[model samples]
Target: MVIRDTHSLQLVWSSRISEDSTFGLRWTHSIHRSLVEEKYRIHDGQIILTEMSFHDYGIGMENELAPGEKLDIQDGQFHIRNMNRHFPALHLFIGQVRAGHTLLFSGTEIPLGSLHAPGAAITIQVEKRSILNEIGGY
Candidate 1:
């Protein structure tokens, strides 16, 4: 299948890193994202990538851990080291590796409900929004 007019949207993940353990340690949640470049396709399978910028943001907090200080994250928690097993890996469209054929964005999986079509072309428009405009600044 030939892809036309492909435009890449750079995504920055604001994922939460959690620590869980059988011990009595309180659960802590911190935000961090892998410095990765995310390119989205309009028709990646059953899901269509719309210009839905509102649905594109992940809300989380900033990380405040001292360097070399390890967090006590037990098994089955949302840590950066264990995130790969819990979420889908980043998608690529080159070489032996190809973009995932599922509805996923920024390591999160989206559900596909009866929108699977074959041989369809989809278009997505990206709107530019400055930080000033987002914060009600003129």
Candidate 2:
């Protein structure tokens, strides 16, 4: 997986992800001031959104569950599961430092704020490259 600056097309971060590799993006809701998280997995070279959880249901939250989707509330948080949504790429706006935009992968936390300035647009996608090509930085 790779993350790039949308406007400049400059690579910000890159990592090798295999099939079934899971990761998550988390940030604070602007209006509700609560935590929101989206979990994803790599499948057949595609990004699949597997689950989403949020602390509040106010503006910007999904109002209703879609077919084959399940909604669960636990510990005061709403979790939507079985989404299985596919995306070629993910575009995100880097929120303010307080929003705490972060990437969770491989049991490590990578704050998006450390990679780009606040309000920057970034694109995350899966890219295929040969081992030699990757090592050569081609």
Best by TM-score: 2
Q: lDDT tens string, model 1, 115-137?
A: 22222232223233455644557
TM-score of each: 0.18, 0.93
For residues 13-73, write the lDDT of model 2, one tens digit per residue: 8888888999999998888999999999998878999999999897999888778999999
The stretch of ten residues in a row with the least summed lDDT in candidate 2 is: 129-138
Residue clash pairs of candidate 1: none
Winner by lDDT? 2
List ranges where model 1 is wrong by over 4 Å. 1-100, 111-116, 127-138
Per-prediction RMSD in angstroms? 17.1, 1.3
Relative to the true structure, how large is the alpha-carbon lDDT of every model? 0.25, 0.90
Candidate 1: lDDT of 67?
Answer: 42
Evaluated at residue 101, the lDDT of candidate 1 is 27
